[model samples]
Target: MDVIYVIDILGTFAFAISGALVASKKEFDLFGVIILAFVTAVGGGMLRDILINSHPINWIGDLNYIYTILTAVVCTFLFKSKIAPLRKTFFLFDTIGISVFTLLGLQKGLSLNLPAIVAIIMGMVSAVFGGVIRDVLSREVPLIFKKEIYASACLTGGLIYLLMKQIGVNENVNFIISAIVIITIRTVSVIYKLQLPKIKDDIFTRNQ
Candidate 1:
C-alpha cells in the first residue's frame, strides 16, 4: 500500500480506538461502542469529503476504514489492561491522526483549487468533526469548545503545511513537518498548562 494510505488507515484505527475507549468509560453497550467507533473513525473524513464535493465518502468506497475500526475495537478489548501506558500513546496517535487528516483535507481542497481560507476550513473539518461527533454521542462537552487548543492546532498546522507546499517543499517532508509542529504545540501547551485567557470571575461579577 502507498504511504499515504497506510497513514490514513493508522489514523482511522487510532481515532476509532479512542472513541471506543470513551464509550467504554461511559458504560456504553456493544452497539454504542460500534457506533461511536465508526463515527469517530470516519465522521470527520466524511464531512470533509462532502464539503469539498469529493464524493461517496471514503469508507463507503473502501471497507478498509470499517475494518480498521473493527480491528481497533478488538485490540482495545484484548489489551485494555496492558494499555494503561497508552494514554500518552493514544494522545500521540490522536495528534498524528489530526495531522494526517489535516494534510489530506488540504490536499483535496487544493486539488479543487480552492481558496486558502476555504482549504484551511476543510482541513479543520476533516480533523475535528470526528471528535465533535464523539463528544455529542458521549454526552460530554466537545474538545474544540473546551479551550484545549484542539482543532485550532490542526488549523495552524494545516496552514503551515500549505505554506511549505507553496515553497516547493516535497509533499512527504511537508507532512512530517506539519505533524511535528502540531504535536509539539499541543504537547507543550498541555504540559505547561498553557491555555487561552479566561475571564476572571471578579471581572464578570463586576460587569454584571
Candidate 2:
C-alpha cells in the first residue's frame, strides 16, 4: 500500500472523528452525527476534485474512505465522554487533517500539470473547505474566516513543499517536512494564543 494513501485514510478518520465529536456536543441526532462526519471527512477533497475536473472524486473512488468515516463515527459515539474532556484532541485531529489534505491536493494538482500557484490554492482549498462546511452546518463562524491562522498555515506549508520539491528533495522527505511544518504552525499558534490581526470590532459599528 502506498504510504500517502495510508496517510490520507488516517487524515480522513481524524476529520471524521472531529466532526462526530462536534455533532455530539451539539446534541445532534445519530443521523446528524453521521452526516457531519461524512461531510467533514471528505467535503474538501470532493470540492477540490470537482474544481479540477478530476474524475470520480476521492471518496467516491475509494470505499475505504466511507468505512473509515463510519468507523470514526462509531468510535466517537462510544467514547464521547472520554474524548470530550480532552480539549485539545479536536484541535489536534483538525490540524492533522489539514496537514495531510493540503499535501494531497497539492500533489494531485502537480500530477495534473497545474501551475504551482494554482496547486497551492488547491492545497488550501482541500485543507480548509471541509472545516468551513462543518462550521457552517454547526452554525459557528468558520475558522478560516476568524482570526485563526488556519488556511494561511496550509498555504504556507504548500509553498514550502513546492520549494522543497523544486530543490530536488526526496518525495517522502518533502511530504513529511511539509506536513510537520503545517502541524507545528497550527499547534504553536493555538498553544500561544496567536491570531491574525483583525480590524477593530468598532469598525463595522462605526460604519453603521
- lDDT to native, each model: 0.85, 0.89
What are the TM-scores, per candidate, against the unseen true structure?
0.89, 0.89
Instruction: Give per-residue CA lDDT, model 2, range 117-145, as digits (tens).
Output: 99999999998888889999999998679
- What is the C-alpha RMSD, rounded to one decimal, of candidate 1? 2.8
Cα lDDT of model 1 by residue, 1-208, tens digit: 2876787888898899988888889999888998899889899988888877887787888998989999988887888777657788888778777888888888888888999989989988888899898999898898778678777788899889989988999988998899888888878888887777666687768788
